[model samples]
Target: MSAHTNPPAPFAGVNATWIYTLGSIVAVYVLLDLLIITDLLSSFADTRSRGMLALVLVSVAAAATRIRYCWFLRSDSGSGLPHIGWTIALFAPAVISWGIAFVIPEGSFFAAVQLWFSGVLFALVASRRLRWWLILLALVLTLIPILVSGMAGDRVELGERHPATVLITIYSLVLPIMLISSLWFWRVVARLDEARSLAAELAVTQERLRFAADLHDIQGHHLQVIALKAELVERTLATKPEYAAEQAGEIRLIAKEAMEETRSLVSGLRDVALRDELENASEVLTLSGAACTLEISSLPAGTDAQRVLAFVVREATTNILRHSNATEASIALAPARGGFELTVKNNGVGEEPGRDGGSGIAGLRARLADVGGTLTADAGRPGAAGHRSFALTAWVPEGGPQ
Candidate 1:
């Protein structure tokens, strides 16, 4: 059994009746064929000419059904056309067998036709990766009626015993096998697709981890230094009163700025600016007696573009002030590939705890990621040691991020 064949969904799921009706009819067609061959319904209909007529009628109906279903699939109106095709395929041999019935007698010629129909059914089931064995077994059972009917056909008179055609036999034996096989195959394919989807999600998670680690280190160091300076000044105030007071005031000011920076990182705001963050970082450093520098590239414009970039800049600046102790930080926003890229760099202490982005930073990343955007940070290349840099990139669709 190969595994892709799908038995198709229930009528409710497919929102269709044609396929189910056709499938029901097919069930009847095969059953009738079998009962007629076994002499159980000799009085119901003639096995020779009448059987041929019946098979022909069934084939025409099946073909018409399949054609209608194919149209349904092509249309945007509804679903289930595909399932109708499956039932039609199962009944196809009946139509062709009917044609053979007229051309040939109720003997070897008719038997060969039944054999051929069995082969067609087998091919269809196997093509969709259903269980081939059940269909193969059906073909074998069909031969029983063909062989028995042929031998008994000569012994009985038309006036008494009814004839059994080979086509009818094949339909009976093979129909059950096809239905069961198609159903089994349907389950296999669905499971495989689900597994593949899950694997892809797992891979994406690993990339997120790397991003989280780098952000924390850069932001933590800056925050720690500011905190330590403030505590020291607070204690010294009691001794060298004038100098202590001055240091205490400076410390109080730095503490206030750091608090503001922390708030920006925590807020769920959508401003993601490469330039603004750098500028803010420069301001904070200057106030703390550190120098600052800024560089910005042209940015693409669209609905809400400026606002989102602002948030990005805000968060980046917060990170720099909280972690890096460097005097200068550079920010840049430029067009890259097919979208815009934002970069923030600062010569901050290599790693610190609070600097590693928290849930707040992760939340900011999610904003872009949700819209198919990405955020990444690098600690700078050689000659750039003691510096941390972040590059945020997002590809806006034809219109823009929603």
Candidate 2:
């Protein structure tokens, strides 16, 4: 995967979810800032309104900073300690808000709550190694408002005693939960980053395995033929020079054929076409004792889409022959909305082939995906006579993917 590749979505693995999540979070925070700051201003009108406003605005800036930073860092490419500049931009508002919160007289409740929330945001954006210190700092900042309130003799009271004690008790319990929850979110993001890396690695590994298998399939038999011809030429070199020369020429031709096959495999253009695939599938199904029917529509030959669909046909046929005890098979190709669809179905699907519907199907799906196509295989619905069948379907866009 490239650096630009996006990490999958918010736990559902969708790619577009981040956009929605970001927008939603921003909207919610904006609403929360308006409500909470308005309430604080009305309740503590005699207090230092300037410091309270600064604290509220700074807290909002802190939350926005963390949101954007954390969102960017959600991708695999975005992991690591953020730059010094980003670190400053992310934490400066939180620190400034704490300073302002400590000085806002008789506003301990709003100020302390704001500090707690902003600290959580800072901890959330912090790297794992740095998060511990940041969480501790947030907790300490949570205490600073009460400490400053006590020293200023402006501590609020819920009953006969100062509410600062109750506030400390509440924050002491709440801050850890917030820290743990933030850490859990970070951990999940880290796992997603790791998953993306592993996925890219696995794709490379599968491609390598595919290349090895194709190389063997293309050249293995030709190599044996060349070997036999070479041995014959050596045996008759002195006794029959002309025969040996002919054998040598045969070996050369065999080698040339192998080279051409290798080239085809390398270029991903194997010797398969839609018409040829239809004929081959019918013959294979017949040999496997299945009655085969084909409903092919006319199409331009040698198109990229035709070649890909032809490969799909070949793979579906091979799967049927190897894995099923079908008595009847049908291959169909026709026009669909803005594209074409191919359906290959066979009766007597004993079991679903593999974890991912067999390697052939998996590989076909990947190839089809490259051309904006898709492959789906299912143990299809029960037929009229209660016979279960397997179906492999592929669809390609009209001109294929860019």
Candidate 3:
């Protein structure tokens, strides 16, 4: 597998359900705030104006939620500040809502609080160096509106003597800190998940290196001995015919032993059970952020085809991890066309379908052909969302390899 240039984000392979759950919590919090703000504004404005303000507030909150979902939860959100256009997009609605709230009695406090909530989300996903700075700036900005409106005799109840003012002040101060703490905890979890995936990949790489070393040692020793014997036989053939014949016989015996030893090594490697491969593939894929499903009818007992199919499953898993950005995948094995068929499918085909047909596919095809089986790969049609699918199917006869 080729190395990726940019490392995946901490949350890149995290479970979608976890992300959505956290998002739902944030949404519910926003909804509650919206409810409180609506209640506070009820006695202050005409029906039409209040409705318009609610609509604007909902839009701003929804936009902030989208930013959290799409960027913050899904990718490397806090790596840096967003572009200038995004910055404008983030703050424009809040500013407009603040302006609208300033005209209405008892509305500015809620608006300031709403704006602070949005700012907290924005700062949560900002670069490390800028996150605290932006958060403090937002806090200061929030306090300004509250302090000015209160001192100006607006009905916000920010006076030193008012209990409501003290409560509001405390809430405003505490809300951002609470938000920052929760999101910080989430970031830490994402980092741990990413590290887990890296460790799995590292383990697989180490195993492959070890296997290669063992194969090299076995082949290197046997091949060197074979070469030396062949040279000795060639030199003796001219004057010592009997000795040459004996040497040639010894060479043949050595060749046979070498072939047998190599086969034994390979058989040991192929001893992996088909069921184990399926389970391992499912687990590894899940860790890498893809949901994997498996369906297997009664598997045949002790057959070469089972071993080959196990290999197919292993290879398919590797391809999905290395070659695609798949979110869902499945492995199914059943009886088909007077034989047993194994199908591996994923919804992660890239723009270029042909890229999916790499040397790995060719190698699988060759392996299947050796066992009188067939291997085929299809880059399926684009779905409604314009994402394509890839399926690899392998079929082997009922009895096993021919």
Candidate 4:
């Protein structure tokens, strides 16, 4: 793992979710406002009276959007998005609300001026992004119109720009849009940061699980075999001392080696080569009195051959031992059309391959899928009629992953 990778902190995760939700709201508001400004809502205005009412309805709907989204932001997930990004998420709803409010023709100037500050304050509270005074500066500067209009005239500046077309000039039109665009930019930054954080967490978790699986496969079966052998030795010792001594001595060596292997496994540096896993399976199957043949033609150079071989050999040998009382077991690895194939077949009545977890075939399928390979179990002939046979086959793509 890269040293730069970091899991999403609790607060960071929470912030990411909020950003996603609020960003969706802002995107919707902008789209709707753009549509409305295209005179789409004008169809609802049959007369001058209705036109005014329709505008009011649109403004109220836009305002209610802010309230609705604030309620959405009240979630209590422990995740914390980056402080900077979350700050942007928190502001997004209000920034969008300002965009919607600013574009519409307002019945009263007070509402138009008030809505911008309201959205900014809410964003500040939710994100704690900027100093209150910094955001308030915009409100204070924009409110200059209200103060000047109040002093010079009577209700003249209610919805009027200082100069008749001041709103069309370089100030209101250009600057407001530019500021709105900046808010959107911050929201995007927050989302990208959040995604990176989640990917890092996923990588860490997968690495941890990979290590655990390695340890389990290495030691679990070794311990099982040692336990079985120790039991057999104890039984023989009671019958004859010399024979029992021989068995005990053999058990001691195997046990000691297994212990050393156990230590090596836990340090997370161990890997079971494909060849070793196949050899281990062969030893296990031979001990169970089944005639076994291994036909392996190719190897993926530089990889642990035993580990790659283990998945097929282990599950196949296991089925031969437990489900089938077969007299013969055959394992083959050869080139296939796409990649390569490994198969194990037995000439005996085969139980369902994955009916139980103990069979390990299901686990085998999952393990192969990790490396973009596949495992399949089938019930059919063992190159002979009237004898039941089960086969486990796996194929891996030539490019290493599907």
| Predictions in order: lDDT | 0.50, 0.66, 0.67, 0.55
Worst 10 residues of 2 by lDDT: 156-165
How many clashes show up in model 4?
18
In terms of lDDT, model 3 sits at 0.67
Candidate 1 Cα misplacement greater than 4 A, ranges? 1-11, 14-149, 152-160, 163-167, 173-279, 287-289, 295-300, 303-323, 332-343, 349-402
Flag clash pairs in model 2. Answer: none
Predicted structure 4: lDDT: 0.55
Clashes of 1: 29
* lDDT of residue 43 for candidate 3: 35
Tens-place lDDT per residue, model 1, 291-333, is 6555566766753454445556656666555555666666667
Residue 375 displacement in candidate 1 (angstroms): 8.5
**Candidate 2 structure quality by residue, lDDT tens digits, 76-185:** 32265556787678767766766665566555645565556555555555555776677677677678776777677765442123223454455445654644554455
